[model samples]
Target: MSHFESCWNPASPQALQRRAALLERIAALRALEDRAAAASARSQAVFDKRGQLLPRQRVALLLDPGRPWLPLATLAGYGQDTPELARSVPGGGMIAGIGWVSGVRCMVVASDSGIEAGAIQPMGLEKILRAQEIALQNKLPFLHLVESAGANLMRYRVEGFVHGGSLFRNLARLSAAGVPVITVQHGSGTAGGAYMPGLSDVVIMVRGRSRAFLAGPPLLQAATGEIATEEELGGAEMHTQVSGLGEHLAEDDREALALAREVVAQLGWAPPEAPPAFAEPRYPADDLLGLMSDDLRQPVDMRELMLRLVDGSELLQFKPLYGAATVCAQARIEGRPVGLISNNGPIDVAGANKATHFIQWMCQLGHPLIYLQNTTGFMVGKDSEQGGMIKHGSKMIQAVSNATVPQITLQCGASFGAGNYGMCGRGYAPRFLFSWPNARTAVMGGEQAARTMQIVAEAALARKGLAPDPVRAQAQFEQTVALFESQADAFHTSGLLLDDGVIDPRDSRAVLAQCLALCADAEARRLRPLSFGVARM
Candidate 1:
């Protein structure tokens, strides 16, 4: 194995400036995330009065202590709740991520009921659906901490109501696939939300607080002059004893969480194998914060970044001379073998062909692929165009699309043009996709986009035999740049759910290891399937 030597200097003025900018970006991401949590935590007094734990508190109590919890979609619906980005809170009124529960790795989703009674926010429905999909894909037990006012009828959209049915359908699918769908009804599940527990394979409800009803007193009284208490309609005791919807009943929030943990423990899941002993990377992971400048246009040695990520800082470079701009290497991350592909510059014809071949070879070897995306795009010029850039680029894309092994992507910097698709961007559905705080994703850089449009405008004016208005054209150029640049920000795209989440650069290795382990476990595990999900009859 060839050990990678680092020439990175952390004390350089340029490096210090880069690190400071990256740190600020990470801090901005954290501040938005903190705002979401604060929004939920504001209702703590109410929760305390009701003898209940906060949504996060409930999640912490249910998860195994000291185990890693990878939070997903922390910026799910930022600015979607309202037009103003600063005032809008993210997280979509939900908390979702992967965590270990009673030694069983499971997908955990909880309704942030503290926020507007946990009414499904703009992207809240999509968030839960994504969680359910991940659980199903990974063969993970689906665990839900339920307490929601269901859809926000006051702000309802026709499309949202239509898409919401998938949530219940996924619950049925999870149970049918033999991946347990477990729900703990902590407070309220009204109207269509009642099916959350109804479709689950196992349900634990808190006695006095939990409620699941098709229609509450007002709706029932309005439709059919019926007078009945909440308990008579769909209280936890009623569901457990009479309706047969709830299997286990707890008196309080803590008891419900304990019951959920105990149920997970009883699932007969085998303990995960202990990881093989491995050496840590030789380079300091902290160097990652300063290694790459904030500007995606500036060139940096991607090999240096890879050295800090892979185990023992060893990499066997593949086809080093053929397409040096596109780096492909064989290495291990946390003892798990991975094929790393990253860009040092725009992919020329040779680089594209190299990547296509490397992708196919890795698939054949059954080693997972990790893409460090930082490319302007495939080389574009007369000579390169004539050299079959399209053909080779397409081949690379096709290979990425059909690769059998799990592919994980990290948008370390620029992800632009077709390069995003060629590198297995979120569109191709990598096993998991994440972004560093400095990552910028767009069709092309703002300057490039603005210049392209300006040239096109000039050509059009020339065709009309008209002179261009320089002042007006300059104004248009600046506006176009601003529009593209603003949307390309990592926080903006992440909030729109373009990627899984924005992560700190320092945490990339740990995050990648956890994701790789998930993929490996999913491959090794076996499941039993049935035609239909278990019904609550």
Candidate 2:
């Protein structure tokens, strides 16, 4: 009792008041921290609901783990008159920086929708343009995580006017300078100003979350009296399958980021002087003969074949979803970055248009092209006719012809009709046009050929007063072995040099790697002007 009384008597009123105030201040600070944490959590939840991911998460997933992200402009929007706007649109809706992707230092821009709906404001546009300028100056590969609502209408109204011409001009200059630009659509990218991602060398969309269109549904309805859902208007399915806008589609944000990393791996560190070398152990030691099958019409998932061929699981595919029939990707064979284009069978006109755009961009980026041919032809039907297949298909052919990269063609199965030309056929004269033994090259598939032969044989037999034996008539047309083989032989004998020789499908990686190594020192040539518009997004 004596010790308690003495301690109670020691504290004065002033001292007690000071202690209480300190405690209150500490409590307030804790509360503020809690509020910040809760806001961050809510933002993350929004991304989760859309099956999308935050910029930080995308950076972590796409880049090498543990590498520091040296942000370019964390306080981008914090200018004298725009303090409130900065607070509202922190980082200008974009998280841009130099980061390590699998140890490759590159410039990356990740869009953050938490601020200003990820719209491109004056400050945001300036931030991106500055980042791009840095990338170009440093000769670094540019990776864009696009989730914009296009231009900010509110900001534009406040500013009187906003012009995208400067942004497009800079992108065009960067592209012309040969910097590889890769884009991933993490959310809706719409309107006239959204074309930046479209103009990139490669574009990958996350299935449900990503969409690219010239306008939103409301705008479309206002303009054309067309009322449609977002999915039908510009979802990943629509863009990839119908609009010819997106290049590839992923199952989710994680996969999209993973694919982006793979794309960077394929590109390697760039100077464009020498292609990267593939790891030696990754090459197939045995001939790849067994990998081929005789069935021409069978659909082999080229994606699987590519994964097996590239080094270190580095098959970076572009526009995997949009052109369901055509496969375009980036990959490394023994470490060399190569552009891969393959047939996914019958894709619509939109797919063809996207494919053409992709190939043109690759050529402009100064990357070599690898063609894997196995297409029947372009899609045909009322829908295709209306979609302008001829115009788009012609564009693809023109792009292929104009490509100055060291082009290599691998005929895996059927390379029929215009599909062959689009895939760098003998006419385009790829540096090396190799074929698997199972390849069937012709104006059309054997079935169509057989039908034409049947009609001709039937007419001849009827004129000869002999019944056309349906069996023998078909047998006479069974020149699958002779005709295609002769075609292959003719390609070789014409001194047109069909291929180095027929290769096993499994050994494609090894063959391509060796060819790339041989051509690494080849001079980079410029393709003719195929695009009038600047690359935008």
Candidate 3:
């Protein structure tokens, strides 16, 4: 054979080494491609099953469609010796980065269950903390898609002993910064640290899937005699109704994501948008005054009234299941964003808790607030007291006071006592406060006032030698119409602006739009500062 023919032969050691090296390199590249494909497939499976967009998907939905998510730590956990516990924990469980949501920029942490059942290990916590820090430093909104079995059990013996406190500290700092944290409980969230979701400004739960709690049922049973199912302990219903842990319950994953997107859209990454300028009045003259009920004592569904007033079906109610009595939501008036806080008139304590949560969320978002006054008052009694209504109520009040957003009050009906103040009374100084002609502003309802006056009359009769005459008493009360009129005067002239002039219910939307437009320019000037501190979880 010729020298060239011999050189081409496969039996030669030099040629053999060359072939082996090429094959080895090809194998390695193929292996890498397969791994990537596997990860993509795994993420897809999660999305398909739950109708969930991964953390990346969420960022895409929230951020402008084309912005790239700049990962904080792409190779966060790839070199550790413990394959299961180290290299995969951080990047695999929590995918965090700075990205744009709509055009608004934000930092987001998404859970990846393909890695260790989406457990939060020490490294995972570190990644989250770092991302939170970035968000706070940049004054960006922080979005967390919480889906984990709390802390990782495998690393408990090693990490639990050393860095357990770090996670909570970081969570607290993010909260303290007023970063406008939004948490979507996508799946199982339990234990002490998992409750971080509760500390967020808005906590959204997936209807039948997502759950959150300080501890699971078994743990609760072990600590105390109380035994309940997972759903009973920390499911969507329990959190929204019993503990007020979740601020919003979505019908499903898509609905939850849509709500999140809507919330973020309304609340841009930085300071909130000013209320829009008033467009031409939308409601007819008759519809403007029609919302007010003549019978002050009769309960009216404020939600219906809000629906009629807000532009389009743009009203987004928050925590509806939690606070049925206090309706808190975000709505558009003539296309201007405004926070709506109204009374459900007759709802349970759970409903009040939800309302409190919704209002707090709105305040945190810095959206302009609108109060649809109609409340007998907060639910009273021992049961309510036990549920920490006072504490939660105080939180609601603080949220209102701390809100830098402009506020406007619309006294639709009964504005009684503390409820009036809590719903942004004239004392709160809404930019422009108006009341419907039928509104009654007082410490209590007119009927109650009349009854008290009747009691006084009866006592006077008892002192004399005469029985209280029902017919005469009734006539005397009617003649004392001045008592009712005084309430209106006190509300308007004595600072409540009773003379602010009764707005026609139909004209209310136009008035609100005008208020929003008037404030919009000023609100744009308010820049949100980067403030970070620890939070109570």
Candidate 4:
């Protein structure tokens, strides 16, 4: 493989400015994540008094130290919890990630119970479901640090309650798929929540703290006029010894986590060996921070970014001359062969055709595809339309949608309109989707959307023999811009779970390598499927 030469000047004024802007955005993303942590930390005093470890602490103890942990959906319920963006704590009231437990890759989910008594927020349900989906797809063991206060009765919606059934259904599906579902009941699991432990293949409960019951004392008293202590109802001892619900019992959170780790270690699951030695990228990964301007409108060479990502900065260009705007290349990320498709600008007819063919070729070669999305979408114009843009664009989207190989997407800049679909955006169910803080995803730019609406509205007025009101027109335009600008921001979209997570530009190589490694692992692992989930019996 040939090494790529550098054209990036880190000391240049433009580069420095871009780096500064990216750092500011990264800081803001980190601050939002810290807010979720701080919100959970506030309950330390309460947890201390009860002699129980916090939710995060339990997760830390359960996972193997120094191993890579890819946190997913950190912005899951960002602004959904409340209208106030600043006050809204994201993460869907849960901490979840794919990490190693006893050398076995596992999906780790811990309810952020410290917040609102670990109530099941609307997005939290979605977050857990997504986690289960990933675990099942990758054939990873599912380990949950559960201690939810169940659904928030005050803010309950009938739809949320109805959709929540899927959570239990997924657990059963995971088990039936031969993916072990292990639950460490750190706290209350009342009513519908009892199924969490009930459906798991392994249940580890804390003697004093873990409580899993179909009905708690208050409900039991209200309905049956017969009350029992929490211990008698469904405590760890009762579930483990008498009810046969829990298989392992522990005195406190620490031991419970230890037992959970031991269970994973004993599962006899091991990831394939690491790849052979590989050369690092020639360019400094930190330079990625300045590779693209903060503004998506600015054109930057996507090749520069790819050079900093692939091994030894080596890339074999595929059909480079035919579609200059669309770059297709063969590269290796951490020694794992991958095909890369990126956009330097809008994908025109030729670009779309090139990408379509490249995708099929990659699938034939059994190489995972990496999409570096940075397009305003497909090119549009009278001439371009005549050039079969739609026909070609559809072919690209079809290849992306049906590709047998795992596809990972990193939204480096603008991902708008049909380009998102063609490039395997979140909707395509990419094996993993991540975005840089500067990335902007929307149907189109705010101004373009507003102008289109204005033109349509003006045409309607003209048909009615009316004139457009300047004042109303201006007001509508501003409102439309504000709406798109707010939602299209990477932070806002990430918070809404539009992407897996927003990452630092400098970490692109590491992040991509990790994702590629995971894809490789998934391909290598084998599972024994069952018609039915392992029941508690």
TM-score of each: 0.99, 0.44, 0.43, 0.98
Against the reference, the lDDT scores of all candidates come to 0.92, 0.65, 0.62, 0.91
Please provide, for model 3 over 1-537, each residue's C-alpha lDDT reduced to its tens digit, 9 standing for 90 to 100: 011111123345543553454344335433433342356447677567767665555545555666544554433443232445212222435677656565555677877655555776555566666666556544567888777777666556664635656656656666675557888887888875565675677888887778777778888888997988889877887788777878789877667777777778887444335444544323233433333445566555666567567665345667666656677777677666678888867434565566556666766876788888877766667987898767766766665566677778877777776777677776765665666545667777555667778888888888997798778888877756556655543223212223233444555776666556546643443344346442323
Backbone clash count, each prediction separately? 0, 16, 29, 1
Question: Looking at model 2, which ten-residue stretch has the lowest summed lDDT?
Answer: 1-10
- Cα lDDT of model 4 by residue, 1-537, tens digit: 544467779889999999999989899999999999999999999999999998888888888999888899898889888899899999999999989899998899999999999999998898888888888888889998989899999998999999999999999999999899999999999999999999999999987889999999999999999979999998999999999999999999999999998998898987577887899988888998888897788889989999999888999999878989999999998888999999998999999999999999999999999999999999999999999899989999999999999999999999999999999999999988999998989999999999999999999999999999999999999999999988898888987788888888888888888887777888888888899999996
Stretches of candidate 4 exceeding 4 Å from the true structure: 1-4
**lDDT agreement of model 2 with the native:** 0.65
Candidate 2 lDDT over residue span 1-537, tens digit each: 011111121145543553354334335433433332343346787777776666667777888887555554443443312434222323445677776786566788877665556777555666677777656655567888888777676556534234466666666666667777788888878875466666777788888788777878899999999898888877888777776667678999898888888888886454335445545433243313333335556565666456566666556667666867677888677767778887767756866787788787787887889888778888878888888888888888888888877788888777777887888887886766666545667777656777777887788988999888767765667765356544533222111223334443545675676556535632432323234433433
Candidate 2 deviant stretches above 4 angstroms:
1-41, 79-89, 158-161, 268-537
lDDT of 1 at 482: 100
Better of 1 and 2 by TM-score: 1
Q: What is model 4's C-alpha RMSD?
A: 1.1
The residue-by-residue lDDT of candidate 1 on 376-439, one tens digit each, is 8889999999999999999999999999999999999999999899999989999889999899
* Candidates 1 and 2 compared by lDDT, better number: 1
